[model samples]
Target: MTTINYISAVTQALEEEMERDEGVFVLGEDVGARGGVFRATEGLYERFGEERVLDTPLAESAIAGVGIGAAMYGMRPVAEMQFADFIFPAVNQIVSEAAKIRYRSNNDWEVPLTIRAPYGGGIHGALYHSQSVEAMFSSIPGLKVVIPSTPYDVKGLLKAAIRDNDPVLFFEHKKAYRLIKGEVPEGDDYTVPIGKADVKREGDDVTVITYGLCVHFALQAAEKLQEEGISTHILDLRTIYPMDRTGVVEAARRTGKVLLVTEDTKEGSVLNEAAAAIAEECLFDLDSPIERLAAPDVPAMPYAPPLEKTFMMNEDKVESAIRELAHF
Candidate 1:
């Protein structure tokens, strides 16, 4: 095992996949020369050359369109959207083409493509750069959505997504890219399957279900809760689309109480979906109403530190929710 950063894990996944499968390649803005805006693709251009690692125009639509067309031909393409917010321009291609191609055509053709992007608030990225758009794609039927909170999960889930025959939207929390570090299994063959929720921390008082940056936040809160004699279980929904509902239900049953947390706005958020699933599958086991702690529906992320802090969910908020649920 080797200790690596989240960005390094992602780069390793791409490089290994490219070596394993000739059809696996990367395309996006500044991917070939600049090695991506966040340097996630650094050193790739030199090894893979310009043909496999392409630098495209600034248009997201054009970049996504190319990936869709290539995937139709059975080539596994990983398209990088510079920022998660910028992916809006490619919504039609994602929802209408890449996502529905397999189902709409009755499995005759499948888009084995992965759309990679850095997301979430923090680092003072302001409104444009910091956004959690997972809910948008989670609502879609044909897309597989994944958000990894650690270097280990980032590497394993990315490889699994690449090998899968369906379209995947991979969200890399910008904050976790550098701040989070963990031991990733060595070698190129290691892979973690999609739709598995990891039990990040074990507890019996209450369960905190989340993904992305919130997973780390929930764990931090769980640590503090432990000190206060409130055992808080933390479940990281690593792959949100094909959600591990069974795992979530089991956690809830073990804890008897639930608190859902996420960086996205609470309204119609992915956490809400998880809570709803728990209610449907494990209502009899619930000791209290599932509490959801998330960002309020503000117009956009604020530039000021104080406002931005209030707009995002943190350890304090997560702990408060856990206390209420555990005592309810």
Candidate 2:
């Protein structure tokens, strides 16, 4: 096993997949020489050359449209959106074309396309660069949404998404890019299933379900909660759309207390589905009312450091909420 950060895991996954499959290629603005805005594609341009590692104009719609076209033509294309906020320009291509190709054509055609975007707050990207766009796309049918919390998980899930027969929206938390690290296998190639959830920590007091950066905060909160005898069972809904309902039910049943967490606004958060599933199947099993922790209904993240903190969910806020639920 090799220790690496979340962003490096992305690069590793791309390199391994490209090596394994000649059809796999990457495209985005500045992906050629700048190695991506966050260096997630560092050295890929040099290794893959201009033909495979394409550098496109600053156009999100064009990027998604071209990738979709390639996928439909039997090529595996990995398209990067500079930031999740910028992806709005390509919503039509993503939601209409790439997402509906297989179903609209009666399963004869498949768009094995992977859309990667760096998302979430805490980097002072202000409003444009720090939006949580996953919640918007999670409800779309025929499209798979994947958000990985750890380096190992990200690498495996990315490989799985790249090879899958359907289009996948892979949202990488920009903050977690460098903040989260884990031991990943080096000699072997592996892929994590897209629809499965992972139990990051096991406890009996309360079940905290989340994804992306919230998973890291929940894990950290669990460590501190253990000191107070408030054991926390943390479930990372790695794939929020076709969420692991069975895992949610089982985890909720295990502790009988549930706390749903996300970086998106609470109104239509993806965790809403998890909460509904628990309510529908595990309501009686719950010891307390299902709770959700998320950002306020603010328009977007603010540039001011203090306002950003207020709009973001972190370890301290998560711990306090988990602790309250544990004692309830």
Whole-model lDDT per candidate: 0.90, 0.94
Backbone clash tally for model 2?
1
| Regions more than 4 Å wrong, model 2 | none
User: What 10-residue stretch in candidate 1 is worst by lDDT?
Assistant: 184-193
* TM-score of every candidate: 0.98, 0.99
- Clash counts per candidate, in order, are 0, 1
Name the lDDT value of residue 303 in candidate 2.
91
Question: What's the CA error at residue 158 for candidate 2, in Å?
Answer: 0.4
Q: What CA RMSD would candidate 1 show? A: 1.0
Output the lDDT of residue 153, model 1.
92
lDDT of 1 by residue, 1-328 (tens): 9899899999999999999999999999999889998899989899989999999999999889999999999899999999999999999999999989988899899999999999999778899988999989998888999999889899999999999898999999988888888898888488888999999999899888899888888888888888889998889999999788899899889887888888988798888778878889988998888888888898777889999998977888887888888778
Prediction 1 global C-alpha lDDT: 0.90
Candidate 1 residue pairs in backbone clash = none
